[model samples]
Target: MFKVLMIEDDALIGDMVKMFLKEEGFIVTRKTNGADGIEALSRFNPDLILLDWVLPDMDGLSVCREIRRVSQVPIMIVSMKNKVAERVDALVAGADDFMSKPFSMHELIARANALIRRSKLSIGTDADFNAPTLSVSAIAAAPVSAMKPAASVEVPAEEKIRLDVNTRSMRVHGKHVDTTYSEFEIMKCFVNHPGRVYSREDLLQTVRGIDSFVTERAIDVHIANLRKKIEDNPKEPKWIRTVWGVGYKFIPM
Candidate 1:
């Protein structure tokens, strides 16, 4: 079973979350202050952490930064701050995912499970580890004639996407991009429908496979991190572009 540490000041909220997590089969240890949360890190050694922005002793962002200085364990910020800038700040401080208050229990569970899966993969514990290997001979070999199309209808594959959904892995321009499952799903949606504008509400519904409980601003945070990893220049993104008042879209190459 995966162990989770929750750093939340509100007793009611912390108890509710702990109950749900226990029911989901996770061993949860709760802390009500940021300082205690950081100290619990060494004792709990949890697989993941669920943190709140406001704490009694210290701000959660400071705790996140300090913990990240020592470990790569996934951290998810569960806060009431719904601003895009706040979410981006949390991500920049080393959080792996961000969720606003009043989030769906189902979505929360899905995100937690995704973090666990990603942690396992990063630790090389996956059963299916068929990452492609490149060789000099294979690169130098001459190309053969193109194979016949599988279907006569000739449905063109979406452009600028090189992800293997079966393996939960993705590559952009020959470089592997590491991302959590939620991030991967969001990116895949854009890649599958290039040049199609999607509002934050639309994206939350489609990508997260749920209702739009999360704020539109949260989408910006995920997009910012996505661009930092996938784009050569995040300040001027190539694949994902903002559409002023409408929303955002993927510009296929």
Candidate 2:
């Protein structure tokens, strides 16, 4: 189920919206103030956020800024301020979208779902990405290699990380890029969807089967290993930069 963090001070509205969203198939966490909403991040790890502009303790814009500092989770500002300037300000403060007050519960749910869907795909944009899914049955049948190995074959090299899926071998910068099975598949995903961000959850789901119990840290470890091989300066990675508070994205030249 998709998780949502809502920061709304209006008790009646907050309660009603939370109940409505729950009915729409979301695990909702409601916070009355910005500070509590900020603290909820560690606990909730929401896929999307619905922030009210005015909060009892602090402005919601600060919450947006703070969340954006560490994560690229989708944020939508729901406010009484209907001006274009207010919407632009919210976006400038790192919100992905905006909704004026007096919104339908159904519309709110639809927008929340849309944001979560977009966040999973990359971050802000919403282009349909058919990220290949690994089946649990396939995982159980095969070793944890993530991909089956095959005999080597000759092929022309691309200007980027070239993966010969049949053999599952890879090449980068005209040289054979040595990689383990998991690393090769990860690279294949990145190269296939260059410029798209993949959160740890995303990488975990795509690289491993959705039903797999792999921890998020395992994704980080694998990424570190891959960066060491691919980046000239892993500390200052060029090809795969960390989108703080987000995940990783392949930067194509």
Candidate 3:
């Protein structure tokens, strides 16, 4: 069972979340303030942390930063601030994910499970594990060896961009393109959807997960980075194009 540390001052909210998490089979340790939260960290040895943005003794961002300085125990921030900038700020301060206030308990539990799964993968504890929530594109792109020959269709000739899930690598125009995890997820969103126009909001939820609250500007930055690696002319992007009023789409030429 995964252990979770929740630092939230609202007694009602704390109890509510704790009860639900316990039902999910997580061992939860609740603390009301930053000092207590910090103190509980070592004692609890939590697999993940559910931290609130506002606390009695101090802001949670500081606590998050402090924790990251010592450990990579996944930190998911809970905040009333839902603005894109505020969400980005939390992420920059060392949060692994963010949940806006009035969040559904169902989504919260699902996100926690994902974080724990990936955390285990990162620590070499679950290398063969893939979170089941990933889209169909992920399963379809797995190594040919993993799929039956009849189901392992050949890559389309018109599709210039390709992904190898077995290697977690991508290729554009027959050249390998290196990617960060965020950029890779963004690419996956496009590859999976084809002509579908995804809003910035859609990408955030799909690429980062439902619990993630992030700036649309963060998406733009990632797109820019991805273009530099894949596009022959970053100014005239070929694979990823801005949808003008909309978000972005992946168009393989």
Best by lDDT: 3
Q: What is the TM-score of each candidate against the true structure?
A: 0.56, 0.51, 0.57
Which residue window of length 10 is worst by lDDT in model 2? 131-140
Q: Candidate 1 lDDT, tens digit per residue, 65-147?
A: 88866666778899989887887688667677788998888788988887777666644466354432221122123232322
User: What are the runs in model 2 whose C-alpha is more than 4 Å off?
Assistant: 123-253
lDDT on C-alpha atoms for all candidate structures:
0.72, 0.69, 0.74
lDDT string, candidate 2, 1-111, tens digits: 888899999999899888988888889999999989999998889888899999999999998888866665677788889876666566556565677888777677776
Model 1 spans with C-alpha error above 4 angstroms = 130-253
- Candidate 3 on 1-253: residue-level lDDT in tens? 9999999999999999999999989999999999999988888999999999999889999998788656667789998998878877776666768889899999999889887876565433667543222223443455535432132335654456776544446776657666644566677667655666889988777556544555677777677878887888999987688899998877645
**Which residue pairs clash in candidate 3?**
none
State the TM-score for model 1: 0.56
Query: How much does candidate 2 score in TM-score?
Result: 0.51
Model 1 alpha-carbon miss at residue 184, Å? 14
Give the better candidate number (1 or 2) by lDDT. Answer: 1
lDDT of 2 at 104: 75
Task: Show the colliding residue pairs in model 2.
Answer: 70-245, 71-245, 72-245
